[model samples]
Target: MQLIQLNLKHCRAAQDLLMQTVRERGSEVAILSEPYRTGNSQGWATDRTGKAALWLCGIGAQQMCDIKAADGFVRANVCGTWLYSCYLASSLSLESFGRILDELSIDLRGHCNAVVGGDFNAWAIE
Candidate 1:
């Protein structure tokens, strides 16, 4: 299965771009973060594949905690699963991001195949 992950800036253009990318790639699963509103909003419609999932990390400080509290940090165990997780971050930082990943690793308990895709506001060199 193909998993497409993106961090939308909550712009109409970004949303359009994400949709266009999904269409072009024929993605079987898509995960998006931020910018995408929740509940009864057009943002939810972007998941055209129906196979897609949205992770709306709340805004500001809550967003930071949300990321740290996410349980779907590892993707191996989350792939092909219908479970969708979203975390929002107010400021992107290495330490903060790493902590979130650490939490995720703990949450997944070393499982790394379940996740499909979503915006992880971290840069790791592997």
Candidate 2:
């Protein structure tokens, strides 16, 4: 399946450009973080806080086995493989980040084929 991942940064222009590019590239799925809420969000699977979302088109939606959304994460099972879009904000405390990762790891432990992509905000200070 053709999938593309990006961080929209809540910008409408970036969102537009991404959609146009997705169409041009014939991408079947879009995994995004920090998306613009004012834009089209109809059938997307979005996190509780709307920090993460993923759009499935045509066969991508049909192949979905399970879907789950959390505060900073959105996950979908497509074609028997798990796809995850996550946003780990740099402002969050280290303990909180560790907890979130522990939970996600527990879920991932049962699956073998998986792809994870997103902005963890892990850029170095130096």
Candidate 3:
């Protein structure tokens, strides 16, 4: 049930650090955005889109949805809870982010117990 989310900024060293920390914390899942990918990371669930990745340490997950960069999201069912990892690029406008949110909600329609995590660079500080 424990989850940690991080924006690696595409650093290999950061990926190593993240793995170490996850194991030390005994976290069941790690949600990553902008992960550094050389080829296929051993435990991380990577998709063709490559915007977000999910790692399940000891727990098994059943994927409910396909990972896509168009919405920047990946979904899986973990022990009855719907888990999602998403990433929103800073270059995208708030409206785009909102649109993605709407799309995600559509995918989440029937799932009551769901957890969504990711690095969203979009923020309204103005």
Candidate 4:
């Protein structure tokens, strides 16, 4: 399964770029962070070919698990695996970060397989 992680910066062109990436790379799943959500992005789950669907958080019920949406995370369960698409705030304090971790741990309870993906805002200095 091909997964593409993109940071849109809330740009309109980024949507087109996302589609292009999907086409060129044959991506099955897209983990978009900071996507430009003007209206409801609920329809974005489906590809042009209708071969795949995007299970956004809080939009609707997915296959096996109920998708949940929070301030910085969207989580869903596929079969038995938990998938989390998250965006961490850059200005978060140490205490706040720890709190988020605690909350996430609680959410992940009872799930054996879990995948977390998104723009973590961690820059690598060359």
Candidate 5:
């Protein structure tokens, strides 16, 4: 299975670029941060149509697995593999992010396979 991760900057143009990449790469799962939105930058904007975002074509509603989205993360369970899409703001401290990871580790205890991807612009990867 192919997984793709992108920071879309919450714009139509970015979403389009994501789609183009998806097509070119034949990605089965996409972890997108900062998808299209008009206002609130505090939360995610779920493509309400159930598929596609702004101008980007999605994997299609019928093709989607069990997915859930919360404040700083989105998750999907597909065929025994769990997908965790996380986005941490640059302003959020590493300690706080560590706490979040701890919580997630607990939640992921039983899962054998998981794909964790996202934009961690907060960290300086030395």
Candidate 6:
């Protein structure tokens, strides 16, 4: 029942660190960021924003582990109105992004335990 939150900053070394933590703590649950927005095929299994979170079942939970591990992972697109100079000219719309979230939440609920990790792109005041 241990939970750890990490901001991986898109470093490969961080994955190694996570594995170490899992070994030491017998941790079955973990969350990591894939900052570069690379897909899982690009040597990284990450969310749409290049961030990813992982959860592992602790020792002696073979049955639980046998279930899909992806069930415990969640990814949310946090890219909000704060557009960088590079994206300023892009045609992506924030309103469309919001719709995606609304649609995704429905399907995602059936997949995993009630936990969410990844860049929310949400401001504290918002």
Candidate 6 residue pairs that clash: 28-56, 34-50, 34-51, 37-50, 78-120
Q: What local lDDT does model 4 show for residue 79? A: 49
Those runs of model 3 whose alpha carbons end farther than 4 Å from true positions after fitting are: 38-43, 46-48, 59-70
RMSD of each: 10.1, 2.5, 3.1, 7.3, 6.1, 9.8
Report lDDT (CA) for all predictions: 0.45, 0.79, 0.74, 0.59, 0.59, 0.41
TM-score of each: 0.48, 0.86, 0.78, 0.68, 0.67, 0.49
Clash pairs (backbone) in predicted model 5: none
TM-score of 2: 0.86
Prediction-by-prediction clash tally: 17, 0, 0, 1, 0, 5
lDDT of 3 by residue, 1-126 (tens): 788888888999998998788788878877888888633544456534687777776444533343333467777766677777788888887788889889888988998898888887876879
Residue 73 lDDT, candidate 1, scale 0-100: 33
Between candidates 2 and 4, the one scoring higher on lDDT is 2
Q: What is candidate 2's lDDT per residue for 15-80, written digit by digit as tens?
A: 989878888888887889998863354447876778888777434445554788876787888777
Between candidates 2 and 6, name the one with more favorable lDDT: 2
After TM-score superposition, what is the CA distance of residue 126 in candidate 2 from its true location, in Å? 8.6
Q: What is the lDDT of residue 120 in candidate 1?
A: 51
Model 3 C-alpha RMSD to native: 3.1
Q: Pick the candidate with the highest TM-score.
A: 2
The C-alpha local distance difference test score for the whole of candidate 5 amounts to 0.59
Give the better candidate number (3 or 5) by lDDT: 3
The candidate that wins on lDDT is: 2
How many backbone clashes can be found in candidate 6?
5
Q: Alpha carbon lDDT of residue 71, candidate 2?
A: 62
